[model samples]
Target: MNFDDLRTGSAVHQFPGVLLGHNVRIFHPHLVNLYGCAIGDDSRIGTFVEVQKGAVIGARCKVSSHSFICEGVHIDDEVFIGHGVMFTNDARPRATNDDGSPQSEADWKVELTRVKRRASIGSNATVVCGVTIGEGALVGAGAVVTRDVPDFSIVAGVPARVIGDTRQPVSKAELTA
Candidate 1:
């Protein structure tokens, strides 16, 4: 669908400031909240997804439904973000400051999170801020990532630990005879 067609009623909100590259498909556009973000060409954003301001999604990425891509999050090309994935941009989050005042943008710094090229984050994963999920890494389902995942590694569980490596070639001996 054309980007102009996305400009519909109040139910769907795709701000004019959002920079969408060629052939970017937002499935169920009326169910998504995207603003001030840059989605590269051939990317598909699923329903119930909210891509916040300053978030950059690279080419050929698939962001599944019920996912939240907060500010300062950069998803590289060919990344697959599974359903119900949550990305945090703050190492410490508080609604109010010590002075008993409501916290504003200036109150805290946004920590950047990067999901490198070809990384696949599984469903219900919680990716903490200031972590770089290295290239071709596989984050297992329900993992809570708190640190940098090495390249071509597979991580699972809370505070995600490296369980395997993706670059390892499958041996015939390990398979059925």
Candidate 2:
């Protein structure tokens, strides 16, 4: 939606240049820094979150508190971003140029990271740039995702490795024993 269609006055004092869909809820508006991003319908953004420009959060998604969703990151529908999760856009970040001058936006390229539908990223996860988190995938807490995760897979640990498939259900006998 356009700027004019955005919620006015007290309802959106902290949010500027944000394209918010109908029923989008941002808890503690004063505590979050959301700018130039599009949040789809029925999405909930928690406190202390910063959703940067060019970031798109899909419908029915829940972004927990203290998370950082940087530019060029696209999260699909039904996604769950847990508390303190961080997303990076630049692979090689530099403070200054070859001439020792301060680096600008044009100095570095922003790599895109896509979280496919139904993915759940647990608390304190760090998702590196240019990787697609497959649909229905589960990224365990404190995971440092450096590669693409397969669909319905459970990934954990630094440099996140696939531990199991969600589709494979544990037998009742195993549960009883």
Candidate 3:
């Protein structure tokens, strides 16, 4: 729902610094800091889901508990972010900025995290920003995604590589969702 309509409640608990659009429903135990982020209606950001500033989350998406949507992230509609999934914008982040000053908004490189429609990032997966996860692709849990994932393919590993296709889940790559 709209930002003004957001009130402090137990079921739909929201913290400060969060910026939500109209008709959006946050499920129980969901906590988000409003910081000028845009989220469309009918999207479900579950418990422990954190959407940072400058993030644009589309409508009708399911962001599972413990998921991290960092700054500059852009997620399209009807997508899924499983539990504990994280998106990183900085390729080589330092403790401070190049000038040796404490990290601040000015220090941010402003990288982009783009998740196309219908793509699903599995639990505990880490997606490196500046890379696009193709439509309908699946990122397996515990995977470290460092490259562009193809459409409808499945990837899992330290440097996540396409190992199978989610279109045929019951086949060789019968991994858990």
Question: What tens digits encode model 3's per-residue C-alpha lDDT throughout 1-177?
Answer: 234543333333344545455556676543544455667667777876777777878867888888888898899878999999999988778788768888876676877878888999989999998899988998888998888998888888889988887677455435532
Please give each candidate's TM-score: 0.87, 0.89, 0.81
State the lDDT of candidate 2 residue by residue for 1-177, as single tens digits. Answer: 233443433445567678787788889888899988888778899999999999998888999999999999999989999999999999999999889999999998999999999999999999999999999998988999999999998888888988777788745453233
| Tens digit per residue, CA lDDT, model 1, 126-165 | 9999999999999988999999999999888887988778
Predictions in order: lDDT? 0.87, 0.88, 0.77
The deviation in Å at residue 170 for candidate 2 is 6.4
For residue 107, give model 1's deviation from the true position in Å: 1.0
Top-scoring candidate (TM-score): 2
Candidate 3 global CA lDDT score: 0.77
Show pairs that collide, candidate 1. Answer: none
Model 2 ranges off by over 4 Å? 1-10, 170-177
The clash number for model 1 is: 0
165, model 3: CA deviation in Å? 2.3
Error of 2 at 31 (Å): 0.4
